[model samples]
Target: MSLPDDTRYLKGGPVAKRIMAEVARDAAKATAEGFPPKLVSITVGDVEAVGVYVRNQRAKAEQAGIGFEERNFPADLTAAELEAAIHGMNADPRVTGIIIQRPVPRHIPIKAIQAAVHPLKDVEGMHPASIGNIVYNELDLAPCTAAASVELLKETGLDLKGLEVVVVGHSEIVGKPIAFLLMSEGATVTVCHHMTRSVAAHARRADALFVAVGKPRLIKADMVKPGAAVIDIGINTETGPDGKERIVGDVDTDSVKEVASWITPVPGGVGPITVSILLRNTMVALARQRALYQATYGTAE
Candidate 1:
């Protein structure tokens, strides 16, 4: 018989706080060097979801001793204007990271907009160059959300050489990078998406499972291997039996907790860790850009 204490809840609060402290130290060092790091977020419209995300990042930036700036543009702006603005940020050394929020006007091409961001300042890791770097196993600049899942798995101390890992989502931002990053660590990783037939069959045999598709409670108790670690990266809001609103993950926490060795909670799991990694990425941009400057010139300044 399984007990309530059989499973461990993996929370991101502690991990994120530790990372924030380290990022603050790095931010202080960069400030002392007269090149304080800053993150510039580009927002095209006033999407409610994007606003919430921007607020969370702003608070974290202040806590980490990094400066955060937001640039808002009208939806009617021309493509040429957007490209020129991105180019200016790329050339400006004060700008440490550039994040373009989504849900832009349909006239503007999202891919083209993301492409305009310089690879050095692409803190979100959506740039093609940043994504390509992971193929060669160069992980210093990997995607933040994907890196968070990897960081959590590292806590388990599972031998990576032959571990069986199943990822339930194949989205570009979170899933693909995770599969590649896991493979780089020698784990045999299988990626499944909406088109993957019998996804649960693949998930039930893994030493570790990562779920990031937007569906709520898609992975039930039967789909998880006993003692397998579960990482839930999905964030969904819905009405519960009580007729009140609730937030949940892709994994059914109530049922799956009884069987899994470790599981991440919906509201407190990957979100915080991912944000901290974003700040950490911002902190490193100074050193990375300084290296580029040195290679181009004789010094960082």
Candidate 2:
């Protein structure tokens, strides 16, 4: 299913393009009706990686016919101060979606900050209310990373009903949500974390494996069932042969690709799809915000 050069890649490029095209159409429609979708990214620190991610979202938003803005706050800013800023955005009629970048100052609680973003504008889907919706199979507003992983599995033509899925992380953001989403689709799910005894043992049983534990090369070929679909959601930086930096997933691609039926390359796989989903969520938020606006003003656009 792939060239020898790319290794049965479940590449996100094609999938993301298709999804973005739909987002663009909806975005255009929203704008034509006078409610242009707008996304706001809040960062409380100068994290380099977070900066790159925000910029990428900005570019993607522009391409999708959505308006985007980023607000950077000093690391020394108090939690209350940041929450106040979020409150301001929450009340803004033009802001359709809100995302709080991670790695905020240690004193600031991310959960509380994310909670401050109105659920209607929580485009990243990190708010407790937004994530809770997944329990009821409400995926339209599910977390972007988890949604991307599910989409990647679909590319393999794997039947979600009664399929075996192993997720090797337990974090609230990526791991837990992906497992819940898989279950909603009727996949039998197993979640393994740092505390999970013999992580490889659990992973070996999966018809589809999702790895997002952040450890590099944590899932190897020996741990994957033959012909299984593998989705590596981990992004790790490592130095390669020339001593330059390279990004890789949790799975050992060279080894896993030999045995797996389909695999996603770290940089080009789930990452693109996640960003696209964020934009798509923005469009959803746009519609929801428009409803609220219309109800308040007695005007339909």
Candidate 3:
């Protein structure tokens, strides 16, 4: 869909590139300092959908000069056994971060696996402590998608201080964290969930709006404030009239772009930036680990 000249489409490539460049520089410095960052991915069972995500992560990690390792566990492995492996990685000084791939076999609880990863090594930011850090304004180790969405907002060059922001979605990973991060930046954030009385009413009053609900086209042009910056963090697959599958975001981009001053396009927006943010978190984890090592052994190693 072609965008109107009045609206600016926020592409993730340039932002991701800028961030990855910084990460690569930091990674190279860390490598020279003998504290290179390494990320370990834990995948349970065979999930075809997850394989694509893992490949992308590995490619981006390599670009950032970070080590990537994939550890595939048996589908039938008990949760306790999986947690033991995660604990082992937590205790391994070589492993800088841990990523738990989604859609593990129904038998194992995803949250349980996330909890097993130590907070210092939870680069994915799924751990409870990592999320809690955002509440206290410790923004370095936030969830990737949430951090990327905020990064895109900052790219608009609007002053976040005292800006009116509406977030349509309250999931722990995306919406809630985004609210906290923005508030930490001094933006007044209103979070709307399924039970909100009038999401559109709140959305239309914001200077900056973010939508992360799974429903496609949930935010129309009418729902957005004119000249507002819209960040669509939701990824949904929809089949067109011709039966071809396509990825889309929560906002109706074609229509919303006409109203919004800036908007992010699905498949080219937050996805790429999210991967870069993951690598950034890896460096943060590595820095924290290096501090601990220095305190304990009087050396970065």
Find the candidate with the highest lDDT and give its number: 3
Candidate closest to the true structure, highest TM-score: 3
Q: What is the C-alpha lDDT profile of model 3 across 174-265, one tens digit per residue?
A: 99999999999999999999999999899999999999999999999999989999999989999988899999999999889999999999
The better candidate by lDDT, 1 or 3, is: 3
- Which pairs clash in model 1? none
lDDT of 2 by residue, 194-250 (tens): 998898899898999999989999988999998889999999999999999999889
lDDT of 1 by residue, 143-236 (tens): 8999998888887777888899999999998999999999999999999999989998999998999999999999999999999999999999
Candidate 3 Cα outliers beyond 4 Å, as residue runs: 299-301
TM-score against native, each model: 0.95, 0.93, 0.97
Q: Report every candidate's CA lDDT.
A: 0.89, 0.89, 0.94
Candidate order, lDDT descending? 3, 1, 2
**What's model 2's TM-score?**
0.93
